[model samples]
Target: MIDVYLFSGFLGSGKTTLLKHMIGQVKAQGLKPAVFMNELGQTNFDSDSVDDGVPLKELLDGCICCSGSEKSEAQIQTLLAEETFDVLMIETTGAAHPVEALDAIFSPLFAERLNFKGIITVADSKRWLSRDELSPQIRSLFLEQIRHADLILANKMDLLTEGEQAKTIFELQSLNPAAQIIQTVHSKVPFKQLEKTTAKKSDDVVKAPVAKLNLDTRVLRFEAGVKRERFEEWLRTLPDTVYRIKGYVPLEGDKYPHAFQYAYGMAQWLPEYMKMQPQIVVIGEGLEGVELP
Candidate 1:
């Protein structure tokens, strides 16, 4: 049976960083790894991160837990039929509930071929500390992500002070004491150690009480190149409800479009060598009819 691992976390919690590390480690060990990624927007910006040779399947425009579950099963079925790999790594959307994602994977058709490894959750230490600032629904989702993991990585430890770090670990431990919690800067952890961990088995998997979040996404296409300064100014005008933004932007005078990411009021721009589609996907609450500059 092939090993299957689920990577769960909130928006901007470093799941992709951990995924890259795992892919490298798996390759180094002479093992093949396949990736299944789910995105909230029609365009998947993170799909570029996966290597060209790796087998990749993406479910876009929905979360696997709800509207995307059927699509997810079909994608997995296609992957199994088309690819030969030792392990399959599934990276769910940030808003996904871990239990629901697992349920989607436990399909009868492919159940015998997969050895369910476990859920590895990446929690932003700073986000947990300030979770109260979020809406009750979002906060509950964040906690549920932590509560269901077999192994939890308290990521972004560098951003927390000594006391805050203590509290972050303490609070996470209080929520799920059975899981091993590790402090990581960029979701870094020992791959060999993770391989030895198995998920806790229970006869009954309680469904999470929280309903699906009323989150929505907006895709912004740039018809003309814009000044970098002006783009940053527009980012500042975004309200706090905008949880995550990622895509490529064509900045004036640059040879290639730059990859842009925004989360928790911070924006990052990375220069790209190849020109990509000049569009940005904004994910947040009540984003319908929202205007972008």
Candidate 2:
């Protein structure tokens, strides 16, 4: 089984920035973990922030509410089947309902391989008060995000004054009586703090039973040695339908294992999990065959 951590926060609430900071400890600990991100556009910084040592995976371009959640779950399963990872951290889009992630993780296909660690939310100390006062939708979402969190990161503490900080902390405590409210600036915390399991005393554990999302799907998994020249040709010939590709292969005489991936349209390569299995996943429009190696 793998440890799964779900992180939720409002847009611009510093989830990405804080996640980046936490990943620094992940690198320092020498604990290589795989990160999955589901977002609106194609841009993500989770993978780029690390020291090119920690392997990161992304599922972007579509929100989890769309076909991306299924695709993301499938990719995670295939990865676990190939190489065992120490942990998996997932960051949902700001607009995504936390229950949707809970449903996806607890589903039949994924439940067997992973277990829930905890849910975390990053709240902006300065803007949250006004957000709650002005926009009811934002307030509801914020409360929902915090209510489910095992940890509430009072991020952006640098922006709040001394008095505002105390009031913000008190308000968060009132809103989420169960979560451990911690003051943090820029997601600064030790790896143990984020990974440690917390006790649950409250009954409201975010069980938003949701209908299973049905998906018409397909898969292809295979291994074929490419002549050095054929390697570049194969890479260039990749169809646009290929949503993601990940695995370890010798790009040049086995000097270094080349682990790479393509999400949406952007792709990157990093040497990792050299001794593990060779695997990759491509998801997109009109998929049908399940080719196996």
- TM-score winner: 1
Where does model 1 exceed 4 Å of error?
A: none
lDDT of candidates 1 onward, in order: 0.89, 0.63
Model 1 lDDT per residue over 189-278, tens place:
888867976888855445579965878889999998999898888888877788899999999998888999888877888899997999
**TM-score of each model, in listed order:** 0.96, 0.65
Model 2 lDDT on a 0 to 1 scale = 0.63
lDDT tens string, model 2, 1-293? Answer: 77788889765566766677766666577766767776654544344454565556667666664467787777666666666667777888765667656656666876877867888888867666566352444456666777778888998788778998999999889988878888988677666877775634335564543333221223233354435466545656655444344444455445445665543334456765435444444443334543432
Superposition error at 209 for model 2 (Å): 11
In model 2, the runs with Cα more than 4 Å from the true position are 45-47, 65-67, 199-203, 206-293
lDDT of 2 at 7: 82
What is the number of backbone collisions in each predicted candidate, taken in the order shown?
Answer: 0, 0
